[model samples]
Each structure stands twice: as C-alpha cells, then as structure tokens.
Target chain A: SQQGEEDPQALSIQEGENATMNCSYKTSINNLQWYRQNSGRGLVHLILIRSNEREKHSGRLRVTLDTSKKSSSLLITASRAADTASYFCATERGGGTSYGKLTFGQGTILTVHP
Target chain B: EPEVTQTPSHQVTQMGQEVILRCVPISNHLYFYWYRQILGQKVEFLVSFYNNEISEKSEIFDDQFSVERPDGSNFTLKIRSTKLEDSAMYFCASSGGFEKLFFGSGTQLSVL
Candidate 1:
C-alpha cells in the first residue's frame, strides 16, 4: 500500500464552487506538499505546509495539515474549469533512511464543470 | 517564473537498449531529483542529488540506474539495460532552499 492515500479518487464540481480533497498518511512527516498535474504532463507545486504549521494559503489554494490525524487537505476556492486536474499530496517522512525523499499519494482526479 | 525543462518529450526504445533522459533544472537551484510514474500509478521518487552526489534514493533506484549533473544546468538519468517495466513518464524536479519544488514537463519513455 502507498504511504499516502487520497480520498474521493475522483471529484466533479461546478465552476465557482469550491473543491476539497483529503489525504491520509501512515507515518510521521516533517512536511507535506501539494502538487497539481495536467493530463500527460508533470506536477506543478501548489503549496506546502510543515508539520509545525497548521495551515497555509496561496491565491485561491488553501492547505491544512493535521499531524495528529496524519492527514492534510487542499481547498480550491472558486474553482474554474482550468483547475481541472489531478491533485497529489506528498509527504517527507521522518526517520533515517527515508528522509528528504517524497512519498506521493494515489491522487484525486478533479473535474470542474463550466 | 523559472521552470525545469526536459528533452525528447517522448522516446521509444527496444528492450536491453540503453537510454538517457535529460533535464535542465532551474538555474541556481542546488537540489535535483528524478521521479517516475507508470500509467495509472502514483509518482515514485528514484533519486535525489545534491552537492554533486546522491543524497538519497528509493529502492526503485537500483544498479541499472544512474544520475549525473555533468554540467551546471543539465542533469541526466541513464538506464544501462532498459526493461519493459521501465516504460513510464519520468519527471525531473529541483528545489533551492526550502522544499518548494518545481518540476519539468516530463519525458515519456516507451520500451518495446
């Protein structure tokens, strides 16, 4: 099983609506990063929140991290059709061997209807 | 904004043949990494390079795989003997100080 897992593998939302996706992980992490990917392309860094930090925001993207639950959520406010893509959460886990390397989640495919 | 760039957007090679994928990471960034994702699978980290050496690598990065920052801007990942399982989209990413990473468009390799 993957270290990070995202819920609602697929989501559909109307334009101007908000889309929220959740990610759960198994281990302790130093930080969690969110990335957006268009079809057939690479990921684009969206936002990152450290374990010590609870929430962060950039533009319409809002990210929240809960270390106690070992989970995070990305909220896209007033999503447009252009925001349609897959969103993945990657974690930098704690410990010796797996430090600094990111373990990605299965990802949630988001679709915005115009 | 600076973006990482990769060449040979798509390549097709035969089994057992050697293939080299190239990436030009964002200038002034010191950390470089290589990741791959097979179709319908999550992205997996292969290796991370810093200070002209490998800082960390996943189990997927085996003896057949190698990464080099042969020059200032270009970082390359080479596979000695390609197998069918090697068919996937390879992504290159770089970070400056913090963990805010930027990724290249990616190079899709198809092993026949």
Candidate 2:
C-alpha cells in the first residue's frame, strides 16, 4: 500500500528521446522528490518540488506537480543510456513535525538503449 | 559531495539470529533515517532519528528493530532477532535539510 503509485511501471526508449513518467499520490504532501537508483546502488536525489510550486527544472530533467490532481510528472529530455535506471517518486507526508521521512513509490523502471 | 556510506554490501544470517547493519551518514547532517525495500516493493520508512532521539517510526519498525547513533559519525540499525520476512535491502540516509536527502548504497540482508 504505497502512497505514491507511478504509472507506466516500465519504459524503454532509444537515446536522445524524451521520457515522461507520471506519479499519483493518495495524501497531501509537504513536497515531492524524484530519485534515481542504479542497479545495486543508492537512490540519488534528483529534484524536490515543494507543494506550492507547480514546476521545476534541473539539468535535462523537468518535474511538474498538480496539487489538485495529486499527481506529478518527471520529464527527462534527451535521455542517454546512462539515464537507464529505476525512477522513484517520494513524498514527505504532510502535517507533521517529522524531519522528512519519505514514502516512496514502487518506481518506474526506465531502460534507455544507446 | 558528501554521501552516506554503509558497510557489508551483503549479509546472510539464519533466522532468529541477530544482525547489526552499520552506516556512516554525512558528517554534518543532523537528521538520519532508515528505510527498507523488499524485493519488488517500494521503499518503506522504518525510523527517523534526530537530536539523539527517535523522532518517528513506522508500523513496520516493530519491537524487534532499533536504531542508534552510538558515536558522532555513525548510525546503526539493530535487529534483535531477524525473521525470513526481514530479508530486504536496508538503506541509511541523512539530510542537512528536509528537502533533500543522501542515501547509502544499502546493505542487502538475506535471512535463511
């Protein structure tokens, strides 16, 4: 029972194409963050978008959040083979004094072909 | 960039045995957390520690599991008695701020 469920559980794309993955959450959130996990590696922090913000950009990645719909999308532009990894969306549960205990989604497995 | 580090890339133990997973969070980070991911499942929060005390814990973090920062630089998670269900990848993380967190490579626990 994950709070955030990512759509398109698996995505495969060729190099240089844009990949878009969407995530939907059940409860309110203080913020939503994206992470990338290479096989047998740690989760790398990608980006964090606060509840008040609608969209954010970093490097070739762009994230859009729609609070009303309780959904978010991560867009990776010009995806490279190196970008192939599992992408997860984590939401810091709102209305708490907790110091960022994030609830992560099942993650979308992205496969980029060179 | 400073990153969180974990020891014993993999640990195998018999059911009912005790195991302690070790982690060294970024030196300056004050907030630390433990999370686990079962095979094919999402990452689940287990506990959060700050100011030398446990700030929050999840239902999954039962009486069998505990966390401590015995020293200034290291954080540890102790499972008094591990079960087969406890087999999972345990991740240690730290954050200087609540917005972004750095995670360790994770210790893969296999309970037999």
**Tens-digit lDDT string for candidate 1 (A2-105):** 67899889999999999999999988888999999999988998898999999999999999999999989999999999999999999987455444489999
Assess each model's interface with DockQ, reporting 2 decimals per model: 0.67, 0.86
Task: Give the top-scoring candidate (DockQ).
Answer: 2
TM-score of chain B of each: 0.98, 0.98
Cα lDDT of model 1 by residue, B1-112, tens digit:
8999999899999999999999999999988999999999999999989889998898899999999999898999999999999999999999886778789999999999
**TM per prediction:** 0.96, 0.98
Which pairs of residues collide in candidate 1? Answer: none
Poorly placed runs, candidate 1 (over 4 Å): A94-100
- Could you say which candidate leads in TM-score? 2
The C-alpha stretches of model 2 lying farther than 4 A from their native spots are none
Best-performing candidate as measured by lDDT: 2
Provide the global lDDT of candidate 1 against the true structure: 0.92
State the displacement of the C-alpha of residue A67, model 1, in Å, after optimal TM-score superposition: 0.8
